[model samples]
Target chain A: MLSVLLASGVANGLLYGLVALGVVVLAKAANAFNFSQGDVMALGGFVSYAVIVTMGYGSVAALPIVVIVALFVGVLSYLLLRPLMDAQHAVALLTATIGLSFLVKGTIRLIWGRQGDYFAVPPLVSGPPIILFDGAVIIPLQHLVMSGGAVLMLALFALFFRFTRLGLFMRSVADNPRAARIVGIPTELVLCSAMVLSLVVSAVAGFLLAPATLIFPDMGFSLFLKGFAAAIIGGMMSLPGAVIGGVLLGVTEVLVSGYISSTAQELSAFVLIFVALIFFPRGLFGGRSSRSV
Target chain B: MKLFSQIVGVMLMTTALAVPAFAQDVQGVSDTSIKIGTFGPITGANYAFGRLTMNGLETLFADVNAAGGVNGRTLELVRVDDQCDPAGAIAAVRKLIFDDQVFAIIGGSCSNGVMAAKEDIEQSGIPFVNFAAASNNISAPEIENIFTSMLTSNLESALQAQYLSDLGVKRVAVVAQHDAWGSDRHKTLLPALAEKGIEVAVDEELSMEANDATAQVLRVQGSGAEAVVLLSYPKPASIFLRDAARLGFTSSFIGTSVIPDPVAFDEQVAVPGATDNFVTISPSRYALDSAEAAEWLEKLTTKFPDDEPHTYNLYGITAGQLTVAALEQAGADLTQASFIAALEATSGLETTFAPGPLNCETHQCLQAAAWIKRTPEGKTEVVGLSTLD
Candidate 1:
């Protein structure tokens, strides 16, 4: 029973980790949180559903459309809010992103509100549940796919940051926008690229997690809240810390639910946030920064 | 002297002509149309309850208009989105009454939202005919102006408890949402279960938007219950069933009126053979594909080209039929008071979609329900019917 619980926790954790990873990347590069990450993820899932189910295309065929649409939205938002990003007005940027979340949410509601309550995207691969330990633990194949997808995306992100020039430009701008600008780096382009990459990460997470969670218009807010918590726990600027934090949060939630009660699981996020704030002001991985939103 | 006499005569004739028009001055009634307002969650997760039902109402209105309308007046529907929240419902009801000035309202898709707006409806004295929403408090204790054609929670709870007793289930587990929607049914279900001498093995809460039900499933499985009553909307209910299947927890899963569309629910669960032992209550007697419903299905599909036939539509259709009946009974000279009087006098009004006869004498009109079961092969069956005693 414990093993099954842990497996389920980790599976859910990976999805959260992906969302947190996007948040961290955007916060690092653009120096502003992308509050609409969850909604963007939902849009990705809906687009996949449209391509795969509605248009009679395979999952692979939907990927390019998802990436293109996400990239367009990301770049468009950055361009529109370029002045705020340049001014480094953190509060204004935060409010703008929150408004963007609403815009995306409302657009989704308008397009798909009448279709149905929940939509099920077929799994990437179809197979029976994988049983282990003398049939004591059962893991759904889709959950395994989601975990593997999350890991693969994380590795790719790491490689891109380490081996790509565009990645270095983003990192340099994140470190010191004025210095990078003086040193001939196109800070504006770097910020836009960071936004695109962040949204792409979220879109991939959406496609991978849609089968397990199902697709609904209001599905994003809860996930956004969870991802925000995971991001905060892992140290807001640390990519690896986000992954660890998400897994830890997921495991703790499951353990609390299993041993105590389900109600406790809902409250566990708040409790974890409160404890983290009191004990570790900088989080487990966050660096010292006087700046706050 | 001749000029003064002519002016006085003209004034007297004009006053006489204006008296009749003044006598017929009602807020939402005009010489050629009657305005009716409907409110529900049009833009949220519960859009089906609001939007689909509204479509059914519109279809019924369209048919009536095509057939020359009722008493030579076309029915115009004014829709307001309540988003299934109490404050939103209250504001919607007020807007319908004050701003829209609708003669009668035929809506209430969410239990809590409807209950929240009940006070405002009572104060306004507008004729309110609830299409969906099964909370007993919405209609019981009889608000003179409000009448529900939907089966109230009390009657459904009794029928559910009776079903369990007939199955000889001694122990039962309940997984319910804690919101107003779930609380209305859960409160009534507990007493009904106690009456049947069934012990509650476990009681758990699942949120409406919950994507996972692992903890609840595990706790319910550990309780050794013979059956489980799932007092939740379709989303959380399906998630619970899916998690239960994943955990190999086998039990008779029972559902309330909220899950009327068993076929869609089975698909939503996305697990093969997961709903083999699942049974849900429906206010509609006939299944969506049954011969009796073919006419409605055709009518609905024709009216809303994008929508598939659903039981929620039937709920609105039934309420629309009831409203039309009341309007016809109220006669050509219609007012809010007359409509309420007509609704109160409604007895044995059969809509063909509801399980049995409906009456508004007690304000809680619906008393019968049907059970829908999904076979392992994914076929939905209207297995049985029950009328609460």
Candidate 2:
């Protein structure tokens, strides 16, 4: 039972980390947290549903389409909010993203509301359960794929951020956009690229998670809240911190519900966020300077 | 001048003779049409209930019109989106009654929403036929001119308890959501269990959008429960079933009308034989794809290209059928009072999906519940029918 809970916790944790990664990436690039991150995730799932289920494409074939749609959404959101970003009213920019969230949600309802709720997507891979510890721990093949896929994506993102030129430019912009702009970093392009990267990460997360759970217009808000909590626990800016915080939060939730009461599962995230904010304001691995103005 | 005055007087007299007089002043009735309004969450999370119910009503109305309508008057639907909130429902009902001036209403998809708007409906004196909201309070006080075709929460809870007791399952646990819908059933179920002198082994709460239920299942298993009553929507219930199966804990899982579609629930669980130990009570006897509902399925799908017929749609169709019956019985002098009287007198009227005779001696029109179980072969079977007090 312990091993099963741990395995499930870690698997769900990785998906939550992916959501946190989207929040962190957007916050870093645009200097504002995109409230529509979850909606983008939902949109990605819906797009994949349309491609794979409605358009009769294979699950693998839907990947490129998801990427294309994510890219389009990212760029469109950037263009739509470019004026607010330029005006430098951070709160207004964030508020505008809220509107964008509602827009996306409403559009999804208009287009796909008739499908009803909980539209299940078939898992990318399916096989027999991988049992261990004398049958005490049972992990489905889909969980393995979801966790492994998220880890691989995170590793690729880490590599891209470390070794790539555009990645370094994004880091510089995050540190000081005006300085980067002065130093010929093409800060706007970096910002747009970050938005695209953020959406791509979130879209992939949605694709991984939607197969296990179901997809609906209302699925985004809960996911977004959890991911936001995860991001906050990770200091809201550190990529690695986001991953660690997400795993910790997920495991804690599972453990709390497992040993404590099931009613506490929803409250566990906020509880962890409160504790993390009080005890480790900079997060466990977050830098002291991670806090933005 | 005298000739012109005489001609005008004669023309006025002839026009007065040409006018027809109605038995009573019906708000929304005309010589050619009768407007019926419906209110539900057409655009929000509960759209599944609202939109589908409306679709069912529309499809039935279309068929009725095609078959020459009720009393030679075509049924026109006036839809209002209440978003499944109480205040929204009241406002929507008010708008439907006043602005739309619908002759009757066939809606109320959310329990709290319907209950909140009950007073407005009762006061308006409009013939209101509820199709989806299941809270007993909506019809419990026996408000005149208001009737519900859906199974009431208290009745379903009591019937579930009775069925479990009849099976001699002594140790029963409950796993229910904490939302309004679940909480209402839970509150009713506890007392019903008390009436049977059976104490619940355990009572646990799960969220509406819960993706995992290992802890919940483990707790219920720890409590030594032989049976589990699931007061949940399909998603959480499926998750619980899957987790229970994964944990190798096989308990008799009983559900209410919330999970009317066993086949859909089985598919959602996605585990082989996860639903083998599952049984549910539904207001309707047939599944959406059942052979019995083929005609309705075809009409619904054909009429509304985007919508598929489900149990909620069945409720809507039944509501429409009952409304039409009463309209026809009202005998072309369709006043609100006459319509209400006709509905109150309705009993044993057969519809396509009703499990037993539709009765409305009281405001609770639907009193029969069908026990549906999913076999190992992935087919749904009706085990029995029980009419609750």
Top-scoring candidate (DockQ)? 1
In model 1, the Cα lDDT at residue A261 comes to 78
| Interface quality of candidate 1 as DockQ | 0.39
What lDDT does each candidate get?
0.83, 0.83
| After superposition, candidate 2 runs with Cα above 4 Å error | A55-58, A176-179, A288-293, B1-24, B28-35, B41-48, B54-88, B245-249, B270-272, B288-307, B324-335, B345-352, B374-379
Which portions of model 1 show Cα errors greater than 4 Å?
A172-186, A287-293, B1-37, B40-47, B58-103, B303-307, B324-342, B375-379
In terms of lDDT, model 2 sits at 0.83
- Each model's fraction of native contacts: 0.38, 0.32
Candidate 1 lDDT tens digits, B112-204: 899988867775667899988888888888778889988888889999998889889999999998887788889999999999999999988
Assess every candidate by TM-score.
Answer: 0.87, 0.87
lDDT of 2 by residue, B220-285 (tens): 988998899999988888778877776678989998887887888787676677788899998887
lDDT of 1: 0.83
